[model samples]
Target: MAESCSEAGLAPPPELARLAEGLTDQARLDGVVGLRPGRGGRRAAVLILIEVGLDGPAILFLKRSRQLRHHAGQIAFPGGGVDPTDVDLVAAALREAEEETGLDRSGVTVLGVSPAAHVAVSGFDVSAVVGWWHAPSPVAAVDPREVETVRMIPVAELTEPRNRARVRHPSGYTGPAFRIDDWLIWGLTAHFVDGILELGGWARPWDESRTVEIPERYLTDRRDTSGDVNAH
Candidate 1:
């Protein structure tokens, strides 16, 4: 099956099937929680957008524009603080995905939601709403002010040992990191992706000895929560 797809340049690799199956296991959902929200915390959610690419399973990520008041120039999942009119976390995630990436909900198959995680810098209790883009659609940075770029990153490439490293902040905080196709995936986004790869059994052995400190210029302007929380 993998060989035929590689030849045809159409179907995804066989691992995509395993990924879809792994995502639905109830036990796997428990491993995704991050920081916990504080009392009277703001609510938020993110869509773990998944799709089968020509090679294997892929994930969608967004680059926030430099103009944004919060998390400017950061790579993050499509999500935001909840709006007053939204009914729940899932709705908020879907709404933000549509607004940020021009994704139509009808083409997406929502698998399930993971436990809510907290973003202390943003003060949001975020839930990961895992979804499969069964019928993939054209997506872009619909709102230029919010999103700078939209990318569908192949899981196989991400698992490459050379592409993995650790990112350290000046505040002495350190965590898993990934550098793929010119984008540096770190902070909360890196942790979230790492958890999914582990639970889905797609993770590969990588050298953890290699570490890169986040640039002081990057940290100087953003919320100084590097020691307390991974800023989203």
Candidate 2:
């Protein structure tokens, strides 16, 4: 079961109050990607850390090291598979965030957990643990072997029409994507971003026709003999 810090009188900051409230209902999240619990896949959790930024609310993301065997050089939330020591998904999310991004868990206030979404390529039932970075702290890629860079991207930039588009994979999968300079946010990460924008009323209309093929660099290790790609 998901834990709730709201009962402890820990409310999200004003900037995220609306989004925190919207996430309480599974239906609201379902609109994102029809989220639900996975039946048989391995379990994992990701921390969706939001903080007030100079322009507005921003989300933290990490670029995985290219040297890693899985999801190499991909942008992702700080998280991993649940460890045996983890008390629950929330604990696992916080622990992974701290390990991957040097995040100070003490500064985060858990709002709630979203319905789990299964990634077919990785075979992990991933749950998103939404939290507010009430007390911001300095963070960086702690280990070069696992993480290459840490970034806090403002939601405003993501919602900009020109920054939004659709991405088509070699597997014939097409989905929403966000462009941040050279980085292309797609796959499961982009789906979550799309949902968050809708939940927070931050989404803007963009040309869905503006579709692009997944970059070759990101697809190097993603494709198989059948021409299918992996989700990041």
Best by TM-score: 2
lDDT values for all models:
0.72, 0.78
For every candidate structure, what is the RMSD over all alpha carbons to the true structure, in angstroms? 6.6, 3.5
Instruction: Pick out the ten consecutive residues of candidate 1 with the lowest summed lDDT.
Output: 1-10
Best by lDDT: 2
Worst 10 residues of 2 by lDDT: 221-230
lDDT of 2 by residue, 29-127 (tens): 777658434656777888888888667899998887888765677888888788999999899999988888878888888887777777766677777
Off by over 4 Å in 1: 1-27, 34-40, 221-232
Question: lDDT tens string, model 1, 1-232?
Answer: 0112223344333555555465567666555554343345566678888887667789999888878655577778898767898877778888888988988876676655667666655566666777677678899999898789999998887899998999877666677888886688887778778878887688999888998766443575355332222364
After superposition, candidate 2 runs with Cα above 4 Å error: 1-8, 35-37, 220-232
Could you give me the TM-score of model 1 versus the true structure?
Answer: 0.82
